[model samples]
Target: MTDFVEVDTAAGRVRGRWRPTTGTGRMPRSAAFLGIPFAEAPVGPLRFQAPVPKAPWEGVRDALEFAATAQRGDPGVTLIPEPSVPGESTLNVNVFTPDPDAAGLPVLVWIHGGGYFAGSPASAWYDGRNFNRDGVVTVSISYRLGFDGFGWIEDAPSNRGIRDWLLALEWVQQNIAAFGGDPSRVTIAGQSAGGGAVLTLLGMEKAQHLFHGVYAISGALADVSAERAEKFGRGLAAAGGVAPTVAGFSSLDEERVIALQKKATELGPSSLGSIVEEGLPLGPSVDGDLLVRPTRESLRAGVGADKPLVMGATDDEFTMAFSGVAKKLRWVPKAFLLNRLGMPKGAMRPYLAANQDALERGTAGIAGRLLTDRMFRTAVLNIAEDRGDAPTWLYRFSWPSGTFGFAEHCLDVPFFFDCLDGPAMVPLAGPNPPQALADQVHAAATSFIETGDPGWPVHEGDRGVVRVWDTPVSDVVDGYASVRALREPVS
Candidate 1:
């Protein structure tokens, strides 16, 4: 039997469906309002500008299915299963709540990750059933991706994707009360690129009012420099046979634009080494207008010092990429690879000496660990350190996956969502993922959203503590000490 419900929003009336949430922490009366437009379709004249508010409509619109995603088709880039739904109305939000009549519940708004180029809000893994059951309203949102979102143009506004996020959060503030949520208590969270989004928002003065707390899992910051962004933008325009302006780009087919942008960043055999060394070409750029400064600089200058933040990275994020190439890398000198990764000449020996265990796994293992630290862990330390005395918490997902034998990237997301049984989870989390670990992660996240703290001690000073999530969770002082070498000033 189908159960139907309706709610009124600032835009219009929306009809959603109710369903039962089951399993270890199951609850009843959870309802979902999927595909609610937070902004007008970013097509035609709105293609390269900031998001426009969705025009109000009459009668109750059915929000039963997921909306169009910014990612065109299945790109198979990410481990999470984010299906692509095609349409112009890609700027949408999916809401899951326990009750529409109930009030004052905290709201969690999620942003999916794909290096700011590709990712979907339609993933089954991102379902808010579990969160709704826990007395919180969950909302997963969609934003523009790739060149369309972040690429620089001669006359177009920069950081269109970021603007999409702000508008969606504004929508939550204006309309979430109808879904029984407290807009004042909104907590923003995401994984990987989405995690990067959380940190970006944390440091953004314009975003401070939209969200109060943040949970950034394996956050990857891109803060692309204006020079690099301009270079890449020019290269992309040349490849597309168009000018770097709205007039020229508007001439080419959308498919041509996508192909040309991809061509600008495509990796070949030789470029693989520089993957983490050279930062991403497209993402939240340090535009002079909206983003007046780099994310770290903003944080260091006491920006967003008042918000509570919980952030962590998996033990071996991005290491699995090297699992099969160990033999090929056997003969290559580790020092050469380290140099190629932009490591300082003097720090190579010390960095290797500090990671003796990884050294035992040979050159491939060392390379993987270096890449992991350079790309993920080191940033976690830098952000925590930059925050100083602010309410910040650090953690490490040290539990190795049963299948891959390493605590890889994107592995902790299902655990964070507490959706162990969601689609495609087994392939990443192994056949039997521990129920208890999910419980711990989810509970801590919930606590952070509902309250301010995430259970463990707040990070304090240089040797702050980090909560390590393994089979038997433990809190270690200076848990990120291994990465201090990367933090050392290069001679």
Candidate 2:
């Protein structure tokens, strides 16, 4: 057994376990400090409010296991595979470092993605051991999810989950040097909702100077307007038979609050069949304080212009959303398309002209392409284009999974973390996934964290360059133009 190592943080001293690197023979072992609290427990009076810094403890606290995670559904019920480790102290952070005494190491703070509803840092796929082996310190954080995190509540702080992330970053800035990480060399990254959080943070005035760079993988950028957010909050409050305030939510049992939140989400209009899908039900709110405007607007106005950014999405991001009956539905109704996407007159001609092969495959294939372009591809492109003076690098995860088929959403996560062998990734990566690709991806990410460049040309000029991750990684120019043109008129 490896020896136990202890590190002192602002809150207290904690002991962590040392584990050797397994797959990569060249890397060294790492020290893992799990379930370290970055904030006070968000229960009781603290429930719906923004996170407060964790109080200092008297003795050495054990950081051996993961802290309780934000509440989520049973693994069996959800399509996404996630860990369900329950506890009161859900606002926690886990750290993996090569040496607690080493100085000047780059740090990567990872925010987990779960559609702004479900996900935890405890999941095996987020292990940072490999990053430690690569001479970087990796920190994975957990924040409030579902209603507790993003549900709009009257009298409660807006974007509480995002606030939690900011606190965690602050903790890292103040304490990471003890673990051999340079506080100034921090890079904040996440996938899916976490990716959205990174974008949201980039636009947040308070988040400036917290991190040097940003990496958003399969990052989603969708939020409701204030009016819509307030309506959703009121609806959830009614579902729970309580006032739409922190006082009412704090009085209810946590489980009841979760159940009512789910009920409220389900009662909303379905995104599956609708042409004009409702924006994400629970996510960062466009509150005047935390977010002055939409994320795209904020970026266009020079938010995070000084921070280098690396962002990308899989080629088939929305295909995973179609399953069971939805998969069989295939094509979206023509009327729904005309009304929902606001396709201009004669738009179909060009879309079909550009995507004849998808049309031949049936509605499902076409719907998948449209959904991907609408939901993720276009949003990412818009963010990239609006990033102003920020040096940006873009990528596309084009390696299709054997089991899931196509380059599905989140397939690149395990590859980026170099955790393809993780059990939670089996269904997504299939067996015998390529390690060579993982090596390249991880190397590039580490390079970005260590330096500002990701070894790709900066995204500028009319035809921006993008690195495509596939069996044979290559670069593509102006790849988004076709899809952007097809969706622009309608968008």
lDDT of 2 by residue, 336-388 (tens): 64335444455666665665544554555556666776667777778888886
- Alpha carbon deviation, residue 295, candidate 1 (Å): 0.7
Tens-place lDDT digits, model 1, residues 1-491: 55999999999999999987755453576899999999999999989888999999999999999998999977774689988999999999999999899899999999999889888999988989888888889999999999999999989999999999999999999999999999999999999999999999998888989998999999988889899898988888888788999888888777888888888888764675576776788999999776789999999999989989999999788777778888988989988876776676568777878878678888878888888898999999899889888899999998888887778889999988889988887678788989899999988998999998889999999889899999999999999887888889345
The per-model lDDT (C-alpha) reads 0.89, 0.81
RMSD of each: 1.7, 2.5
Best by lDDT: 1
Backbone-clash count (model 2): 3
Candidate 1 versus the native: TM-score? Answer: 0.97
Candidate 1 pairs with clashing backbones: none
Error of 1 at 441 (Å): 0.6
